[model samples]
Target chain A: MKSLTKNDLTLLVAVAFLTLFAPFILNPFPEGSAMAQFNAGYPDLMQRFVIFGIFAIGFNILFGLTGYLSFGHAAFLGVGSYAAVWMFKLLSMNVIPAIILSVIVAGLFSLLIGFVSLRRSGIYFSILTLAFAQMMFALAYSVLTPITGGETGLQLALDDPRILGSSQTPEGNIPVPGLFGMEMRDSFDLELGSWVFTFNIGYYFCALVLIASFYLAIRIFRSPFGMMLRAVKSNQQRMNYTGLNTRPYTLAAFVISGMYAGLAGGLMASMDPLAGAERMQWTASGEVVLMTILGGAGTLIGPVLGAGFIKYFENIFSKINATILHEWFAFLPDGLEDFIVAILYPFIGKGWHLTLGILFMMVVIFLPGGLVEGGQRIRSWLQARKSKNGRPNGTTEPAE
Target chain B: MDAIILQILNGLDKGSAYALIALGLTLIFGTLGVVNFAHGALFMIGAFCAVTLSRILTLSHTVIDETKTDFLGNPLKVDVPYVHDIFGIAAGNAIIDWAVPLAILFAIPVMILVGVVMERGLIKHFYKRPHADQILVTFGLAIVLQEVIKYFYGANPIPTPAPAAFKGSFDFGAAIGFDPNLIIYPYWRIIYFLFATLIIGGVFAFLQFTTFGMVVRAGMADRETVGLLGINIDKRFTIMFGIAAAVAGLAGVMYTPINSPNYHMGMDFLVLSFVVVVVGGMGSLPGAVLAGFLLGVLESFASMREVIDIIPGINQIIIYLVAIIILLTRPRGLMGRKGVMED
Candidate 1:
């Protein structure tokens, strides 16, 4: 294997640092402060950030690298969740066997769907994957009630057999998901005057897994296989004419992405211990697509950034209501404050989707390369300006 | 046998909706060469037009009728619709009863306008972009449209009943020498089927018979050659988009009475309709219509109690299952032509 470039190593280090201290970085405001409401360091939200980040990274391997816009990755994610939960029910509370089982099951399911869907390209592939996912969703919601738990979703019961460990904890409670005897839900809080920060075991576990997934993704992106996937995206016709079979390359990418989704799903189940049929829906698939595109599809950090951005927005926006808006606008005149709240009301709270939709449209229209590209453009422009300003004192050549 | 006939009737009614929506989808795809993900939103808007019209008709003002007393011994205020004042109470009530049919007239112009604006404003810019870009933008638009509808309608299904005249079910089995309630079908569903047929026929005839249609067909086949021939094909395509929108809108307007118009109703139909379009063969109009009915009937049949007893969960996923099989085997769908998104 080829060694990582200096740039690649630097990027990996930066990502590792950011993810390692996310609890501190994400919670910039003090707990008692007004700005604390904007903080996203809570265990649940933090878990989602890394989990969805993993999901998007996997999705990026397929869609960003291979240009296969699968609208059914959620099916694999849901399958992973179900598999993990079942593993817990059948085996033990340890997340290792459950996560491993999830990846294997989701990989198998994706292989089957990909083998069929990969025969077609473009819109047809999208539709095919979508159809398969919908079929899974329908079955989960209705017919596969025994395995999937129907509308209520699959949950652990006290009667489940755990050959490796006790079914019930020493405290006479249903055993929580954990590694060996170490519980996932246990958290320690650090307080400093008005500031408080929580360190959760489950969040750290998810963060480590996300870092591993991210490292694997970076390896895949830099590998020869990644180049072949990109080649498939660029020109399938040319590759075929060159006597190179693109199907296996694409199928591998699809399976890899599917496993990533399964891992994310497993982590989610390890956190919550439930898997709903809605997790397999097309809209959920669309959300992953949105996250990938919004951050920048082909770029390494884009999917993770997009996932974090969307999850953060979903959490923050949904928490704001009319009362919050009123409080925010209270400094204005009496009539004007009420008027401002009324006007701003619909775009927040339950209307967050509207704001999200409009933002998505604007991004697609104006920033096709997404927020990453926008950042690059801004950085380049600023560099250009700085170079022009220093041209008199130095060489007149343009900065690279 | 009667039960089978009833199921078939149910299938046809459902198929009519699928066929209608798919027809508009195909029209847009054929002429504009764009895959419209927001076409379902147009159907939703059409349904809301009826809801809006009925609301308008029943707009009322409070009148203090001292003859009536409240439970608190205060004079009761009676609200009388303005329509009741202009046209007597019975006539106004009758007019409100026929709000849905009246919505057809109201929806055509509004749907066309909406379609034209959507095409000119957003879709026009996306014509030369990649299909992925077009799909994403249209999907975004669909979400925006849905959220807007939800904001106005409060996310609940608002029931819009059929007129009193078409409220009852007709005993078709009795007329055909079977027991009286054996093959009974709703009068509105029959009307809807007939209406869909008329619109489908009208669209086909418009494309097949008219000179404008001939030009549009030529443009669909080869745009550069038609442009070389000095025709303003873009404007005509825009009109065709409006027509397609009207068709979808009319379908939604009629469908309101079948299932209540909800904000997410468009999304509910969107995936299924796309499946119908794909199974129908991408840009093939007749294929879209044929596959729509075919899949719709298959869906109804799969939902039968006996079928469910055997297959267990076939009812929920029959359409998608059929789609996957057809896509894998047929590839180009049931009636797809050469060189239309074949890659």
Candidate 2:
């Protein structure tokens, strides 16, 4: 409820570290065991978790803090991605320069969009943002082909001038930019008995950046600036009557969030070495909104959890086929097995979206504050039962 | 001059689709005040209705001819539909040829039922929630609907052809004393334009002439006052939602020949239609249609080779760019009424 204490922060950091090194932690599991799937050690997905976490965290600063639900934040992310990719193509392969340039470009872009969109509050703001995002998407898909690469998307080639890194052979070899020859996919695998423990160097790099971003978010949340943003959310007219300009504060939040998106975009290109216009599509933007709301928008840990949950489901649900469903239902009677499979059929493959839709509706209908509020409700209910039995639980009610 | 006229004609056909879709969107938003993101999906289902009808009409049973071995030295097989015998060749051919037109009859009830179910089951509950919640739920519903269609139809564009009579181009240039090739436009596209005009006109006339429509319009202006007059405004609005869905569905059904139906086709148009609504001024019905046509025409113009060479992706973004300019300058849109979401 209260701001996290130093000890609490330390404990959270330790848990995060453990989660990052989960493959090593799960080294006790036999090779190809079902438990091995639980390992959050893959570089590609781990980078996604952190990158999207950054995105959702930035979004929360605006929507979670100010109660402004933006339907078009993906525009900024796309802008950031394009800028980062441009940096990769034109300047150097070094991520530091690319990320810096991306943040600045995205920040400027957001500043312009936010300035116009923020003129209207509530639903109008949402529509305006959506309009701008769509405009950007359409432009990228068609007119901006020279820059955005249209539908097929922009890719790095062997001929791209790597001013800061060693050049690879121009014949069918394209290199992913790295920090001083440290490849993004480079990983160390340790064999422990029958299990394989993998530690990706890229994962650690992403984790370090995520930690720094998290710390920055914490500082922002705890700052006076955050209080003003909350005030704007609560009552902008009152804030205006109080002789305070709320525009700058809202714009600042928007810009900061945009920069965070840029950082995420830069990291994405660093890991994958490509940028596509599809990344900027309104749906991609909507995904982050879902992640933020699902995780418990406004809460620091909620977006991360939401990101992990969605990504995990995306992976697991896509892997499930009709055969897999049949195998799972093999224990039942022949008639019942087919019946159950039929019922479960719509929740797998392309039907995975049906599951997500039902889940989203359930969350919105029941858990408005998302998983964080759901967690708090459970904790309080348990505490209430304990107190009724004359055992006072030390945990207090959560702050809004 | 001929090229310009042809382009204008082309623009009119494209504009008609945008106008119809945006009109439906605005109707729901104006009256119910719920942004129906699934409207596009309803449009898609309408197209799929034509696809379904075509497939049904073509349904056949295969027969093997043991004596008719050919190139592969295997038995030749023939496929035949039961309808081929029952209806005979002429009637069967007519049915197959007219599948798309006949689909309009089937699409109406289906889309209206979908609309009613959507309104009563989901959107009815969301009346008091924030617009964000409405957007999210509707978005989720859209995804669910699209995915369901994709699951059944697979993720490919299914071509639904126009009727044989409407297959060729109309020679407008010859009628106007110009070269025959200069102003040729597809007969189907002309039919689409006429269809859209009729639907739009019929919708306006119904609202203006019928007592029920008048009451519904009154409710759109003020629901509480209409309710105080002892009318069931909610039921009327629900009906209005159905009408809106039907309109969108009709648009989708007619649009099949122009562009093949895909699982994600609705989404491609949804954003653009929303932009049309905004540019027309939010919650304004006429504004939506006007903006839709205007932007659609502008988009067509932007797609000209010379114009495209100058501005590149201008055609793709022309509508959105126009929307931004209109929103910034007019704020309430070209004909936006005061106090309608201005707050």
Candidate 3:
């Protein structure tokens, strides 16, 4: 792969800045506007978007680079969350210690899980990971309820001593995660005409971290280790015959990805101050898989796009109701209006799952390479059409 | 000794479900090379068959009882169904009593039709896809089926009680020369165990003794070779899928009384059944049956208060823990054949 050009790096930095400011940009519309409904500017959901994006990116590192599809990756995320929450409870309200502890715990957990699960390859590996995940989920829900908080989940309380920060108030307010004296949620609002914008400190913090993660991922993708991982994906037997210990490399990648998940998990609890067992469910693990595949696995930017797309759709779809459907069909005739609304009824709110299911099926069937591939195909088609229209000579002239 | 026997009987009742579902899963995997993740959904559908049948059997119409007087001093009336009048009290009561048993007849064709439709519509297209793709599609199908059921059933566990004849516990100790209460087991549970044994035996016999069975085994071993011999292997595989569906349906039908069927019941059992399949070694028939019973007994042991206190949640994770240990020690699984998922 070519090294990142200066222009490309600049573009990336600019994009990162924009993402950090996305909440402000998105909040311009009135609260009641349709676009406002799609605003991912909220603290909780924005944190989730970046956190999940990070999670998927890490998953893509293992799966995309090494071609090892892990069905149990969510277990690491769950474990990380639990670890971070425990840190908050036992130590301090400061997120640094929580995040660091979470990453270390998650890394250790993955080392053990990956060591055993990686013994087999392909479907066996997938099944093994799945078994471990289910076991963890069950354990988390039942036996470890005291530690994991069972179905109710673990949360921070006022009783927790703030060794690094002020103790949370008795009103049960969420303590804004801070570094030094700078609080993450502190933001400034700007108004212009009918539009409003809010620039949040947490958004910048998340963006800075995301950019750092992306840069590290890019570096890894270009490194010798990445080449070795690709070699493992392409022909493991060939690599083994060439005198390489593939186990350590895979284990290293697993741990790195696991730490990323821990970071995401820590961020999740830092923003919300709560960690639920439901977050560790197999379904959550499956969701990350869907995001990776949907965005185009093996591409650096794809998982982020996929995460954003799914989160966006999830927000928009769930907010839709029968009233919205009725309004959408208002322009039609009396009989046709009701018919159209009825036909569209099951794809909204609680029925949004139906839409997601259909989208997943369509993507798998038509665009196995996912949204990135779809975009490339469309671009190439447009280019072909343009060239065909421009060519008038008997001999086709190629652009240099 | 009596406690041991009672626990053994309890284990068998649970074992019956695991065995039947594992049998179905192994059948499909053995023949189709496709993991039917929606097998649990089919089981849930079968349970609903009992619920639907009970609802149908008890349908009533009202008639006025003109001879009775109300608290307001007006003539009172009672409404009754025409079936009650025509069948008379004893026969009508018998019809209601036999609702669950009669549901088997209703479930078989319906379950088979569902199986056929699922195979022909969704799964047939996925036969050539990768295992991951197949898993994803089937997993999606399972979710969709479960959600649809939830939408209709309102997410509550609906009971499907067995007939009055099978309602009470049996004093097995009396026959075995022990205290009656010490060795007692539910009559319905024992019936379920027997029914599962018969179905398992029947399935095994059919596969072992018949020409169809011979062909299916041959196809499972090598489909191309079986096809070269002019056998329609795909048809056999499709039939095997149907058989698997029926087995899961039967398991659910019998399991309704033990644990009331809910929309999410299939999901709850799915992971455990997959563990059973894996422990038995993927696509191994006898291996599946053996592992199912072994895991079932182990789960019962883990559920004991003493064991649970020692290792909390062991009951929930016992099977999976065993599976991981087995896979690590033996990558091909306990009985997995060479070259299966080797690629």
Best by lDDT: 1
| lDDT scores of the candidates, listed in order | 0.93, 0.83, 0.81
Predicted structure with the largest DockQ when compared to the true one:
1
- The CA lDDT at B206 in model 2 is 92
lDDT tens digits, residues B1-343, model 1?
8778888888998999999999999999998989999999999999999999999988999999888898998999999999999999999999999999999999999999999999999999998998988999999999999999999989889999999999999999999999888888999999999999999999999999999999999999999899999999999999999999999999999999999999988888989999999998999999999998998888999889999899898988989988888988887889998889998
Quote each prediction's TM-score: 0.98, 0.93, 0.92
Encode model 2's per-residue lDDT on A1-400: one tens digit a residue: 2577785487368647755665565355677865554455556666677788788888888888888888888888888888878777777676778788878988998899999988877766777788888888888887778888888888776677767654564455766666776877788888768777777776677777777777787778778998888888889889999998888899899888888888888778777777887888789888998888888888877787787778767765766778878877799999999999898888887678778877877787778888889999999998788887885655667889
Off by over 4 Å in 3: A5-18, A24-29, A166-176, A392-400, B59-93
Name every residue pair that clashes in candidate 2. Answer: A143-B313
Winner by TM-score: 1
Docking class of 3: medium
Candidate with the larger lDDT of 1 and 2: 1
Per residue, candidate 1 scores C-alpha lDDT tens digits across A161-221 of 8888778877778899998777999999888787778889999999999888888888999
Q: List candidate 2 segments past 4 Å from native.
A: A1-15, A22-29, A34-40, A89-91, A142-152, A169-175, A389-400, B62-77
* DockQ values of all predictions: 0.88, 0.57, 0.54
Scored by lDDT, model 3 comes in at 0.81
Positional deviation of A373 in candidate 2, in angstroms? 2.3
Positional deviation of residue B15's Cα in model 2 after best superposition, in angstroms: 1.3
Q: Taking the tens digit of each residue's C-alpha lDDT, what string does model 3 give over B198-298?
A: 98999999999999999999898889999998878888788878888988898888788888889888977887888888888888888888888888888
Please state how well chain A of candidate 2 matches the true chain A, as a TM-score. 0.91
True contacts kept of 1: 0.87
